[model samples]
Target: MSDTEAHPVRISSHPAQLQALEPVLKKVRTRVGDIPALLALAEDIGHAAPKPGEGSTAKLWELLASVTAVDVAAGRALEPHLDAVAILAQAGVEESKPGAWGVFAAEGPGLKLEAKRQADGNVVLNGSKPWCSLASRLDGAVITAYTEDNGRAAFAVNLNDPGVSCETPLWTSRGLREIPSGTVHFDQVPATPVGGAAWYFERPGFAWGGMGVAACWLGGTVAVARDFRTALAKAAENGREPDQIALAHLGEVDRIIASVTAYLAQTAEWIDAGSSADSSNAWSEALRVRATVAAAVERVQTVVTQNLGPAPLAFNEAYGKRMADLSLYVRQHHGMRDDAQLGALALKGDRRW
Candidate 1:
């Protein structure tokens, strides 16, 4: 059978899901300038967003993509909070309060957050953590800190704690300008351990959450591609046929978008089926999806910008922002480093093929 016959195109749930959020997304498009407003939005999404591995993993990713298609920064602000909730759920911990959350796992050379066991059988965090986005605005966070044995563990802490202080970095990035990621300091801040040592990275949910970020990247790409399509439609309506170059770019954009959509759908199915429960398989799948989506975002950005020229970027506020946000957002993939890790895994005979 041919590829088309083997796999028929099915209607996507994204349109219906996005339709339901049109009202909220309309507000997001205009009022996405402040942290407080974004925090509120993230909290609302947290209440409604689906968790991964719940047999509706595709819906969860589609929701993420839908939000990102509206505003990339809003999606960035929302993803970590949702990921934190998912982590809590996976760890069987009840959310202690009703507020926005963040996940701070990025570590730096000198900065380190240490988790110490108190005599009262509780954990306290000390030192500083890097790359904590919206740390000052968020109510809580799921942070990774070094345990006594020099192993990293996940801890849930209240950001409002007196011992916790956020040091705002000199963020000068044009993309995602509204969301400034900075360092957070903890001085004897009380925390609740979510899971045992290494559980944070070991859990299949970690990979699932990473893939959710890729969905956001895909959404941003979709938004940019839409602009390219709109430009072509406008030209055609004005009695100007798009040249072969423009058509070629559009074809490439379509292929990239279709490939990413199919990859995400198939991976979501695997996750919901429990096939990605294994740590190695989950890691491999997440790495591949993230890498693929990241590359697609880059190519789409290039072709869209090349096709549309500098006019839209200079005058179109929304288009420019989407381009910039996607450029920065997809950099979380770590380029060749992640690819090297995947290669190492394969070298160790962790092949799915």
Candidate 2:
């Protein structure tokens, strides 16, 4: 592709959905460091975005990618909200209130949150849950806790509860500064159970949600690649022809973007076609797609930085932030550990090829 035509390719087959999200994403760009405004914008996106596995899974991922391309921090805040909405729908629970939601399922080495069943059949959560992103800002969240029987279950709880407390000033990451992930403590906080024991992980939507994160990585990388293209285009407009090495870097970027986009599109189609109905298949697909996209994102970053040199990183605010945010965000893929898990699955006859 020529410099002028080297923009990130659209992964969405549905034009209407993209059109609908454009305005909301515009608001997201304006809301940059404003957490409350960004959360509200996430709600707007939730209204327009499709729930995964309802036949437009590819469109859902496309929406995520488009948001990340606009602003990585905004995309970071929006993803879990979208995932929570999908999880609620899958669990057949009608959202009691309309507000931004988050999914807090990450377990830590410290005290595990416990769910105690009350005599009235309600459940109350106690102890601390780590890695609860935007917990202080979001209205509600779907959290996982261990029940009395030592089984795990997903519960929906109101963050506004008097018993809920989030540890602020704890997330010290330079990347995605707007979205601070911290530990949230619950003191007899009442919660409504969403799914049964082990249902959260067993559900196909779990894998789909993980893949949604990969979509964000893809979008952020696309934005980085666009910066490189924009720089080359400017150079060309100034009567400067890019050297053979620069052209070679652009070619590699184009190839990486195309391959990752096609992989995500295919995975999204498979999800909508019920190919991920089996839990093992769903996780396998998610692992492969996430690892593939994460590696592609790293390559694109390397090529862009190598070709553009340190000028952009030192002078361009957007380019620098995109690079930092993507670098941190994609690390959620767990690198070789995920590869090891996939290898273990393959050992169990999970191979498709």
Candidate 3:
């Protein structure tokens, strides 16, 4: 498809009603052969453009939850595009650029998103968004733009709209070309607000919104492990000389994956118990999760590259794409660099350390 045409990808509306979503979920797993296309759509347009078939907000959330859950089930990673949409929705913002570096992975104020509203209540947006993970293939995008009311508003816009544009200027480093991370420009695009000013950050789910990255990171980590195991098994059958160093790296990757899973489970439980508000514990846990994921991803990438012998990186579409994809995906955790600070804060216990 050309850059001008709207790359159509409709989300199901009855996503929350498990029975209704099962089929779509299955379809996504088997049919997602063109990730770059989807990324381009999401990054350029937005998730809400075409309006999902399952119109209910609950259904949309259900669809997202199902996607993430299925990612967990199938040993596949939840596409960052989905995580981006969920994060924006949870923030109660009218629009969100899902791909900004730390927006999905850490604490502090997230990406600075700007949306514009006209006197007629028609919103127009103009801004450059980074890390729009699947920019090339999204039908719509929820973005944050400023309004005459002097407040930040969130809304969804269609990428196919004349106002929206995506530039796949550079592909992320992770050997995977499926997710084309790039900049998206919005110029006088029409948008629908999500809630209100306070709603953007005041929503109950705002804090946990950033945590979705951890889940995606975990999923990518799993993929790397699975890929490596398959490669290892194949090599053994061929009786090829195995690289002891690479084998050690694989073992390390496996251990890190296990640790990441444990950390995520703990984090999820904490989120369920409403403990995420305690910035001390919450941020601390998030930092550790981030660090663990980064390490795990690095190990997996290294092992895979070493074993694949550069052939995969240069040619194998799936394996190469996965590597590139994972590399870019793991970069989201740089926010974890502050884990120590969170730990220190935890020690203060309301004393304002």
Candidate 4:
């Protein structure tokens, strides 16, 4: 499509979905921005993208739909940046900072960031962080670090500062080529405290953010499913009638897509209703939904790949990229480890789930 002719990606499945996304989509068309237009739309939405005490799940899902529609891999990169901003807002950290600032909180154990309290009570960070997506380009980040007292606390660090350095993004092997996702090293970087130690995981928004990532997974799977839809349509176009097996597989793909859509809606309703008010239960709930949706994504991938055969992967650029991108993205949830943790969370405490 020509620049003047291009329309906002038609990825949303319903009117409410379209309604929630129109504001960002409109701005995306008019403005030239550093991030992708999809992400520019998200940064425009800010805290409005449905979390605790924010917008509804309907709005949040719309953003994910539009994002994945723009590009499956790029949306994963957008998720963390948006999640960091939402978390900071939810925690009231850097509330005064303005503009399209992006953050990546790649702070979950191993190769830690250390926080030292200066004489004036200001905080500085020192350590190496891995999987810091968009670190080289983002305005700032709220990263987890070990404090002088040996506790985990989150410090909001500005990447523009001299003390912070992001390693060259080397994701050529996996898929997400557009995203500069890589490692970051911090050396006495000045920062502001988001909250006291353990605040990052303890906040109710953590689970909410996790579910947002799941929404991205669901959206990307939809993209993959669409490729299958196109293949079937083309088969009909060429007057090559699908045999019984191809027809059956197409039905399976539709069934999986329908199931995932319904689950996403249910999740959206619960999020708007504030079922995630409690951090503990919310974490388990996020895990359950993420795991369930993760399984659904896997099913969709299997159905799409098996039904369409090897031709799409070898010949179709769009389909191949979506497959590779989603294959790598969904692994972020891990295969068995996440499931085991979900089980442990469910059984360990009457309050966990």
List lDDT for all candidates, in order.
Answer: 0.85, 0.86, 0.52, 0.70
Native-vs-model 4 lDDT? 0.70
Question: Which pairs, if any, clash in model 4?
Answer: none
Which model scores highest in TM-score? 2
lDDT of 1: 0.85
Go through the candidates in order and give the C-alpha RMSD of each one to the true structure.
4.9, 2.5, 9.1, 3.8
Cα lDDT tens digits, model 2, 46-90, are 886799899888878777887788778878988999999999999
Candidate 4 stretches with Cα past 4 Å from truth are 1-42, 52-55, 95-103, 107-110, 349-353
Candidate 4 per-residue lDDT, tens place, 1-353, comes to 32111222232346544654555545543532235554555566665555443646656665765566446765665676677777777777764444445555565556787889999988888888888776665676777878888987777777888988888964666466666567789888898888778888897778887888888887777667667767777788899878788788778877776776676676667766877688887787778878877887898888878888898789977677778887787887876897788778767873432
Superposition error at 112 for model 1 (Å): 0.8
Q: What ordering of candidates by TM-score runs from best to worst?
A: 2, 1, 4, 3
Two-way TM-score contest, 2 vs 4, winner: 2
Candidate 4, residue 257: the lDDT equals 62
In candidate 4 the C-alpha lDDT for residue 281 amounts to 76
Which one wins by lDDT: 1 or 3?
1
Give me candidate 2's TM-score against the actual structure.
Answer: 0.95
Q: State how far residue 334 of model 3 sits from its true place (Å).
A: 1.8
**Per-residue error (Å), model 1, residue 162:** 0.7
TM-scores for all candidates: the values are 0.94, 0.95, 0.63, 0.86
Tens-place lDDT digits, model 1, residues 212-292: 999888878887877788889889999998999999999999988988899899999889999987987999989999999
**What is the lDDT ranking, best to worst?**
2, 1, 4, 3
